[model samples]
Target: MKKRIVIFGSFGKVGEAIDRDLKINTNYEIIAPSKYTEEKSKYWSRNNCDYDILNFKEIKKILINLKPNIIINCAAFTNVDLCEEQKAECWKLNTDFVEMLARATAVTNSHLIQFSTDYIFDGLGGPYSEQASPNPINFYGKSKLAAENAIKSIDCKFSIIRTNFLFGYSRIGKKTFVDYVLDNLSQSKPIKVVDSLYSNPILTSDIAKGVRKVIKEAYLGVINFAGNDYVSRYDIAREIAKLQNLDTNLIEKIGINDVEFLANRPIKAGLKNQKALLDLNLKFQNLENSLLEYLTQLKISKESIKEISKNKN
Candidate 1:
């Protein structure tokens, strides 16, 4: 008699991490669907539970049929510059779909856990706390902020987690800032790193744990789940190069003005995690430690792949 959990964007970095974490920590039945894969049906129960999130009819039907206790939404159009150009698609996924989920959750009495971004702030005075007011500078941020409000306006029970600068290993090679730096440096490709903008980079596993705590406590309202260090993008690049023993000199520091983006980005969008620190009683990993652990995991994964290839040969 476990409480069933339905996870959207199940193949994305955060969604996949949460799905993996729950499999180990909780006995709850988990349903994770790939957006365009029929192969996922072999992994999940209920034949109708597919990953087609944009299909409102299918989503509603799933909610009504499953009546899950929790729905963790990690699905979002996260490309900042792309979001500026695709305003309609951005709102449809980030805002409109969230409203639909909020309403459906209300019907099922399911607690909704929605992931968000730190870009909601103007980056004028940060790192911001849970109490800080939101003034989004980009369309992506605006759409997410709207989604947050949509959930809040509904009578449904919900938790919004605002995090920044997420870095992790994606099986599908979906790259983060860490990946971009590592890939470029490993190939001896000269990389231009942003020096002015600052953010706290959190591990995907850490964010999943924080979300688990939120689900356990059924915490309502917004909370910040981010890393401990507030460092520049260039600082992160240097750290990665140092850990991998790569040539740090290949990394060039540049300001925000150097990069041409379709959307306006926040300069200091780091989040303050004091609330999560006290409420969840969870200790967060600093940037250096998190990166070290992630790289170690990556090494192990690579070794495992090599071993499998050797055995086959």
Candidate 2:
């Protein structure tokens, strides 16, 4: 019999990519949970994978019943501002749920795969390594860091993957960095992006594939999985415009503090993929190439029209 894997937040971007990739390439049975209503069920369901509505308590019951050998957690509270406002809830989902999952995984003798973020670092420097000390400037980062610690504190075998600036398809909201910038540019609206903030914009599919590779190789411990290239928010916008044949002049660069934000942001969020590359022997595409592929997949020909059509369809 093939091994069974239980994926949390399987309806989200990375989750969907993982579900699709595994279903097509592996013999492992993938089970996911939906938190939507009946009329909204099709919104969450994709590619005929087994799915059911579940809460945290219900999730535990499902895990016990299924007895999966591997558990990949793609669920997270990623809204930076909301995390600051709902610190307790963020802790509940980001930190507490991880602890619960770790304990359950330990009980079942299952391997755990948890997603983390580069926001754990304060972005003091460029291209941070796995060994860099994390000093998060916001509640969201703190919650994820706490969760990472919780997973490490447990006695179960696990892989903590730290990534940033993710873009991909989802059953949920559709505002990505590329979409936001491209949309603003196409409308001839002057856009201001932080020149200080920097990180690799990782494709959701790449992250899913990296996680799968880690599982297949039976790798353990913390790993930094991200794009091979480092880029600033302003640079990303400029590149998106360039790729889609939009006017790059519309993407005006501004200081980090210039943009009003509810939560504090790190100055540089890029991660070194050497560890992941060495361990998994994985090669990540550069930012330009990755953006091109993403644009092509969405069937975007021009910058201005891409966001509207992509979101609407």
Measured by TM-score, the strongest candidate is: 1
Q: What TM-score does candidate 1 reach?
A: 0.95
RMSD of each: 2.0, 4.1
* Per-model TM values vs. the true structure: 0.95, 0.90
> Candidate 1: which stretches are off by over 4 Å?
38-47
Which residue segments of model 2 deviate by more than 4 Å?
A: 38-40, 43-55, 171-173, 300-313
Worst 10 residues of 2 by lDDT: 46-55
Shift in Å, residue 178, candidate 1: 0.6
RMSD, model 1, all Cα superposed?
2.0
Error of 2 at 131 (Å): 1.5
Q: Please report how far candidate 2 places residue 94 from its true position, in Å.
A: 0.3
Highest-lDDT candidate? 1
